[model samples]
Target: MHFEQQTPLNAFLNILFDRYQEKVPAVKKVTDALVAQGVVKSQQDIVNDHIAFRTLGVPHLGIQSFEKIFLHHGYQKRDYYYFEGKKLNAYWYAPPSDQYPRIFMSELMVSDLSEQAQKIIHRYTDPIQADPVNGLNFNDGLQIGEFFHRSLWPLPSKHDYELLLAESEYAAWVIYNRYYLNHYTISVHALKEGYNHIEQFDAFVEGLGIRLNTSGGKIKVSGDGLLKQSSTVAEMQEATFADGETMSIAGSYVEFAERLPLPEYADMPANQLTPAHRRNGFETNNADKIFESTYTGQTKA
Candidate 1:
């Protein structure tokens, strides 16, 4: 939501919310308690609604080389999800307007794991022989926002990230967070009304003591309940590994959608509705429990 327009899609979404709010401290402890509880007026009046990534199906990378930087800035590629007990594989694009923010992106079926987890994910994506976004320079929007924080390989040994977090905590988070930005959504029916639904924004994010990803309930919905999600459980962050040692792992989180409206636009006129009468895309059982907002069973429940 910080787009001051260096435009290559606002410098790839302002360098992915400035390095995902610096490794996600519940994203500025919930955007500074939603700008000190007035809940709107900063963090660009919050309304992102989508921004996820976590790939590594191996060979040059996943989700077909990380959705060619938002399908080369015009997005589009919708639907198609598949979790199947988290072997994972997903999609959902549709941006190119509505001032951008809709992209999901997932992957990690590195041949459905276990051959010692595809030989420890081809031992760090087998030295990525090619397609690091085809060696970038994709019309430089600050070099595609620093090619999503570069470092495309090597650096995974905390016993190979707890042996790929015991076989797939989404492949030990894309083999040590390569491509990082793994969550950022917050479009609670465009707020401004008692925090606009998601059970009143999960009771204003559990009255700011935060920590909500209760796996399948602290709100999820969407079986025609018109999309209502919740998240915020992945914020551990210390990590050094590559044998140097350091620990606190999990790292990113902060989602809270709502969407609604579309029961044939219910009664429209929520200011004559926009974002096309709401309830759009995403909901593979509410994103397979919002990908366990960075697992370890919701970051240790």
Candidate 2:
């Protein structure tokens, strides 16, 4: 979050966003459009609500291993969320300080999946006898940053990729894009008054021709009505399979979140309100649909 100084944490987060932004065209497209609209002067002017990553729930590689990088950087693990239908588990981590974006990490529940699906996942992951994070020099930020993009296992064959896709699209995604950032959010509430609400923000994004994930309506609202979110359908990339065959597959995307003031803080003026005054954590139902931003239904819609 604080990149002015080259601290290990800063280097790590900076590179993550740099690499992610470079690969996901939507990230720059959204930011450029916002700037043109007078939403903010530059990318740094926009507050990041949170960032998310997807993992495979296999030995030596699920949330337990993936979270060490952030946890070591002073993030405190927070609420847990389970997606029964998706066969996954997730948790959101609070940053050391509000200046940093919260983390939402999810893992595909390999065991809960069909036997064939589990077999497909393990075929690659089983070779990782030890958790890779333990071997890294956590003191070096660039090393840790590189670890996120490093391959833990060889790419799965195209047949295996489709086999897993048939069962869990998440599994197929993780197999190829391991440890890559799934998405980063722009805090819509932090923008100017007219652009500080979900409806207006979504409309503006739509006007720019950015396709939104429509799984749970173009905008997903929490039951408490304090957290409203929407995301662009993922960018599709042409991927060459291990077998030399290629296909356009889903990559990362961009998300916009508007966290309204909590009931007790509803009377507080905008100038006085801080992140503390808004909804704090993610909602399971909202996330359930947000996960589909990279899904076939949303991408193909």
lDDT winner: 2
**What's the TM-score of each model vs. the native?**
0.33, 0.98
Candidate 2, 165-212: lDDT as tens digits:
889999999999999989999999999989999999889888888899
lDDT over C-alpha atoms for residue 128 of model 2: 97
| lDDT for each candidate structure | 0.83, 0.91
Give the Å shift of residue 192 in candidate 2: 0.6
lDDT of 1 by residue, 254-292 (tens): 888888888888886787888888889988998898788
Query: Clash pairs of candidate 1?
Result: none
Q: What is the lDDT of residue 112 in candidate 1?
A: 74
The residue ranges of model 2 lying beyond 4 angstroms of the native Cα positions read none
Candidate 2 local lDDT, residue 133 = 94
